[model samples]
Target: MAEIVALFLALCVQLLALPVYVLSFLGLWDPFCKKVFFPFFMEKTMVNYNQKMLRHKQDLFRNMMDFADPSGKLSVLELGTGTGTNFQFFPPNCRITCTDPNPHFKERLAKSMAKNKHLEYGNFITTPGEDLSQIPDASVDVVVCTLVLCSVKNVEAVLREICRVLKPGGAFYFLEHVAAERSSWSFFWQQVYRPTWALVFDGCSLTRAIWADIEKASFSEIKLKHIHAPFPWTPIQAHIVGYAVK
Candidate 1:
């Protein structure tokens, strides 16, 4: 009977943990994820991952000079600037306004901006990428987006907003993980894994045809290059880095 009681206790414990698993899987545990888990995970895992891909990031940012103000008056709008991880990549003296849907990340993003000491912080608006009504059209000199396209509900709407905010000849710099070519084994596996993967990663789709979407957007000049980045051996490592000029 003692053994039976122990087994019952173990089962109860497992049952208690089920909700967390379910919430995590459904990407609805945003508070716990953004406040606790992502802070720790991003600092440890993604920071290192991004460090490995700094060259690609640098290549994308190099075009900033082509569109930015020389007198330190450049205005930048960054979509989905969670935790401000990409703050270090921006050119010095840039006036940067950042936005993300999650309010939990605002504090951490503030702290990151405090530490960076390079760019001037403009505002931290808690809004989704699909809507940017707070920002005026053709007002920003550059818009930066990195690793954000995969999770937004409407990719095209977000793309339109990015295009709308930029000044004439303004640059849109992005680094995104894209769907692998349809013919490859990588593409096959990405399709198989995407459902559960999106569940675990807060609705991030591993198979988003982001490159094609960017290509189809209304940009006067668009140049993108496919480059493999170091992410744990997975089809998600297929990345696109470059800029589109509006």
Candidate 2:
């Protein structure tokens, strides 16, 4: 029965992805994905997943924000700030700058900001995570990335940029779904579905061991833990949430 459900979900994903593939050929995939498809899909489907992960997010944010500035004011930069889902988790009065490769997220991001009025908005920059040249070195007090590394073209380059933009002793917080254990059935299916998953989800790979790249990044101190997220999809249930200091 579990396998049957997985298969059905995969079929649904494929059906939904067909239009995205067609749009890709016309160079409209990015706008459609960021502005319409993903926001709508995630809002509709991710309610349970977001609720289950709320406590973890709260704990991680509390720790990072506390360490970032004792006074509770922080200059924060979020990579791939899709729909500004993390805005509510930020500390009060935090000045947040957001970045996403797709310029189409501006409208949704503004809506999210409107709901979370405690935090100050610091402009959204349209850029990929691999290159943050516009942000000066060692400037931001906190850098946050959640559910982003799996899709980046170069995980190593993104990590380098994260470190570059972080101030000395700044905190870098991340929460990402990763590949499951090698011997697990989920891992086997993850390998099988990776290509289709990436294509459908705008490059989100199902089998990337993202924690390994975070470990290799140039951070002075690192701490992370691997756990199974409560995602209904078995292949992406494996996740890691932690913070590194630069």
Candidate 3:
């Protein structure tokens, strides 16, 4: 009974939080997301919730680093750079242009990355992942989005912009948690939890079929790798990791 009550409360909290965060994302509240999910919040809860999720995140990072070019001269761009934790993996010679609509992140990343300012040779625009109109075409060599796809309002528009900015043969490396492939258990939990999950996590959805979405867009050479056996959001056996090239 206690466990059931706890679960119900969790769902309720997520429901209460969702609409507020969504409005913030629509730019009605500006950077409230960072305050809601930054530092300890994301470390504990999912932008979309997952149990056994953290272990897989480390593994996903490993895979992403391995996929990157060794020359370190690749021009890269990342969307939804929440805490800038991925900054450590960028090669010293790599010049990555990162953007996010969160003002808290804009300031924190600038402060945290002050020492390595020289590595970023290009412009870091203040833009959301869904709109890259501010950035010119054919400017990026690698596009990365780690655990961010779930929150974007328009996945197709962002992907279209990604294809446009990526130089021919450039790579798109991503690690995201998505709907599980096949599991009655996975299906049941995801379906049961999705509503409250997206609410508390600021529009992050576990049921999104990201691979299909990416492939449907104008890109070639899509590669996907499933992590472990279940889902990336939970380690009890839930993790998915994938990378694709354009």
Q: Estimate the TM-score of every prediction.
A: 0.86, 0.87, 0.71
Query: Cα lDDT of model 2 overall?
Result: 0.84
lDDT of 3: 0.65
Give me the runs in candidate 2 sitting further than 4 Å from their true place: 1-31, 69-72
lDDT of 1: 0.81
Q: Evaluate residue 168 in candidate 2 and report its C-alpha lDDT on the 0 to 100 scale.
A: 90
Candidate 3 residue-wise lDDT, 1-246, digit = tens: 544654686577566777665775688633454565553465444433433444545544454434345564667788876656566556656677778765555555665477565456466677888788877787777888877888788888888888888777677777776776555456456665676666555677877778778879777787767554443444123334655667
Model 3, runs deviating above 4 Å: 1-40, 43-72, 111-118, 229-239
What's the lDDT for residue 163 in model 2?
A: 92
Which 10-residue window of candidate 2 scores lowest in summed lDDT?
Answer: 41-50
- How far in Å is the alpha carbon of 7 misplaced in model 2? 14
Model 3 TM-score, 2 decimals:
0.71
RMSD of 2: 3.8
Error of 3 at 230 (Å): 8.9
